[model samples]
Target chain A: MEPSDEALCQRVAKRDVAAFELLVERYQGRAYRLAWSIVRDPEDARDLSQEAFIRLHESAGSFGGRSKFSTWFYRIVVNLCLDHKRKRRWWKPWAGDAADDQGESFLERQPAPVTDPVDELGREQTMKDLWAAVDRLAPRQRAAVVLQVQEELATYEIAEVLKCSEATVRVHLHRAMNALKKTMKNMEKR
Target chain B: MAKHPETDLVPYLRGELPPAERERVARHLDECPDCRQDTDQLRELLGELSRSIAEPPAVNWARYRAELREKLEARRGRRAWWWQPVPLALATSLAGVLLFVAVWGVGRQVPTAGDPVAFEEAAIGRNLGLLEQYQVVERLDLLEEDLDFMSDLDGLAAGRPG
Candidate 1:
């Protein structure tokens, strides 16, 4: 039987390296995807995911088991992403399309070679649309939506991640989905 | 209580409505054309969402997993060393900060060695001397007033006494 996350957490609190590794394996992809969804950058997501795991390892003893392991884990990832956003708030592209297009082209050039054509195309388009829609959302709404839709966290789990009431998470999700629907409708027109 | 079919449409589309509420929405949708059309669109959007799980970029899982192990090992290794508890660290930091502030405050409060105690003493002496001088000056003024009163008393006595 697979060890429960709580069991793994207990071992992790005891400094069991294997338990920590298992925890990392279980959470890294979801954590990375959550971070990527928020920051919209692969490098930032990788760094944030690693940072979160490192932090979780350091702070495992403080886990109270009051919430699900993933909820607690997501709180770490979301806080890191919020910190990155706040830090980058002052820097802006003063110039127009030249800078914007340059950034896009740079990102395009870095995309890995497509292994499966269909999957690759779908992944690329979905990521593009998702990020574009997410970018238009308020920061909290974006965080809520990403945690809910992509990470498959329930409203209560997202509330823990967001440090808000579940009702607040629901509201954020509703607004985010509404905004996304509007954005998608506009895209469909074009 | 069942919410209006329109009100529950979004949650229903996400399959998040309670079972009874879900049935109510389904039943209402069969009878309401507008709600049915709206539900179809919302269902389509939800479907697209389910279909749109992006493929994660290619990663070297062996390498990634190895790196993760190394990270956890490093953390455990650090924890084993000195084995500092968080509360202890927090207390130590708080103590260090308080000690720094106290030292800083004392450093500011006490006079430094640029001037000797003799200089402070001399300044005190000068201030004391000025105070004494003022006191003497006041005394002299009082003496003048006494003299003027005595003269006035003499004048009154010469004019009124037998």
Candidate 2:
């Protein structure tokens, strides 16, 4: 039987490299994907996720069993990604084109739909526009939405990761959904 | 009609509402077409958002693990160097010297017996009681006049010349 994540985390606190390795293996994909969802840059995602793992190694002793290891770890990753976004925001005007080009490449690599071509194309456009709107959301709102839709965390769990109340998480989701709806409507009008 | 649970709609769709609140929202949805439409729209939008985010590009796990190991080793090495005996001793000595200098500097600022400022401060401290009784001192002339009047009364009471 595999040791639970909490058990592994305790061993990590003691510098058990094997246990740390297992934890990394379990969370690498999740951390990277969550980072990618927030920053929308592959290299930054990889670096931020790696940095989060380093932070976990350094601070594992402070875990204190207050929350699940996953939640604790996610807080680390989300904070790093949000910080990266904030630090990069000033230079984004110059970097925007490159990031968009990377996004286009990623979109092109997506598999084609097997369903009705016309409907899929329309839906695809809508999804693209919706994501673009998501990209423009306030950092915390964007983090809240990604944690909700992509990570599939519970509302309370998102609150723990965001270090905010559940009510605040709901407000974030509410505001995010309203913004996306408004964006979709404007796209339709255009 | 109940006020629309506009904020609660998202939580309701996500099944995050408490059972009683969930039931209330459900009944409200049954009675309210606009809210129901909003719920459906939210559900659809959330679904699309979830589906739209693509999987992250594949990473070479071995390379990543190796790089992390390298970085961790470097960090440990740096920490170890700081804790080594010679460097640790040097750091301790430097810290001790700094502490001594700080104490000496503070000690020099203390007012000594030979210091002019200390003499001035002592003079003020001794006169503080006198300064406190300034109002009584201001009435000294009145007290003197009263004493003279009493002396004259004593002379009259003794049947002496005023």
Candidate 3:
């Protein structure tokens, strides 16, 4: 059986490098995805994820077993992403224009390898748009959307990640959805 | 019919509505083609959005792990000495010494707030003494000329008066 996250975290606190390796392997993809979703740059995503792990190691001794390990881990990712966003200007792509015929050529040239038909053209267009929408969202709203819709985290879990009340998470999601609809409408018009 | 539904659309899209509200909205959606169309569009958008899975590009995990381990080890080495009781005293003393030196250097480099005024007063006093010596004390010829002129004036005034 796989070791529990708490067990791994406990070991990690004691400077167990192997345990940390396991933790990284398990969460690196999610961490990178969250980072990329926020910053919208592959290189920055990788670096941010790595930095999160480094911070995780440094802060391991302080992880009380109050919440799920993923919850704590996601909080770290969110903080790092926010910091990256604050530092960068004009790095994230605009959402609305990716659906033009120009983007079709780009997509064809460099397709994601997840060859399921569901992951094909329509879905890719939407994903690109989704990132654009996320990029346009205010920071808190974006964090809420990413944690809820993309990460599939519940409101309470999102609250933990964002350090806010569940009601606040819902508020952010509501506002973010409104913004997204408005943006997507404009994009469709274009 | 209102252009938009009374209910917030997102919770409804997520199927998070209460039974009474859901029924109310459902009844409204049935009559209002616009609301129906909006719901359908939102559903399609959500469908499209669900495709954003957590996929990362391929990386050499073994190498990455190794490098991370090395970095952690180096960090550990740097901080491990601080945690030890034996070396902590020495480290603390060294830190105190460095701090003292830094404070002394800054103190020497920066004049106190009052020091400039004191310096200006001393410089002005020296300049005034130099001026007095050059113009009055050191210029004996000029002083003697002034004295002779004053005596002549006094003699003329006395001759006129008596």
Best by TM-score: 2
- Which candidate gets the maximum DockQ versus the true structure? 2
lDDT of 3 by residue, A47-148 (tens): 788888898998988889899999999999999988766655335445432322232233233323332235458546656665665666677777877776
Interface RMSD, Å, model 1: 3.3
Q: Candidate 2, residues A165-185: lDDT per residue as tens digits?
A: 988998888878887776655
Give the TM-scores of the predictions, in the order they appear: 0.61, 0.74, 0.62
User: On a 0 to 1 TM-score scale, where does candidate 3 land against the true structure?
Assistant: 0.62
CA lDDT, every model vs. true structure = 0.70, 0.83, 0.72
Worst 10 residues of 2 chain A by lDDT: A97-106
Ranking by lDDT: 2, 3, 1
Whose lDDT is greatest here?
2
Winner on TM-score between 2 and 3 is: 2
Kindly state the fnat score of candidate 2.
0.72
- Give the per-residue lDDT digits (tens) of candidate 2, residues B115-142: 9988887677768897788898779978
Candidate 1 chain A worst ten-residue window by lDDT: A95-104
TM-score of structure candidate 1: 0.61
Task: Give Cα distance to truth, residue B12, candidate 2, Å.
Answer: 0.9
Q: Give the least accurate 10-residue stretch of model 3 chain B, judged by summed lDDT.
A: B1-10
For residues A6-52, could you state the per-residue lDDT of candidate 1 as single tens digits? 88988988989889888888888888888887777787887788889
DockQ of 2: 0.46
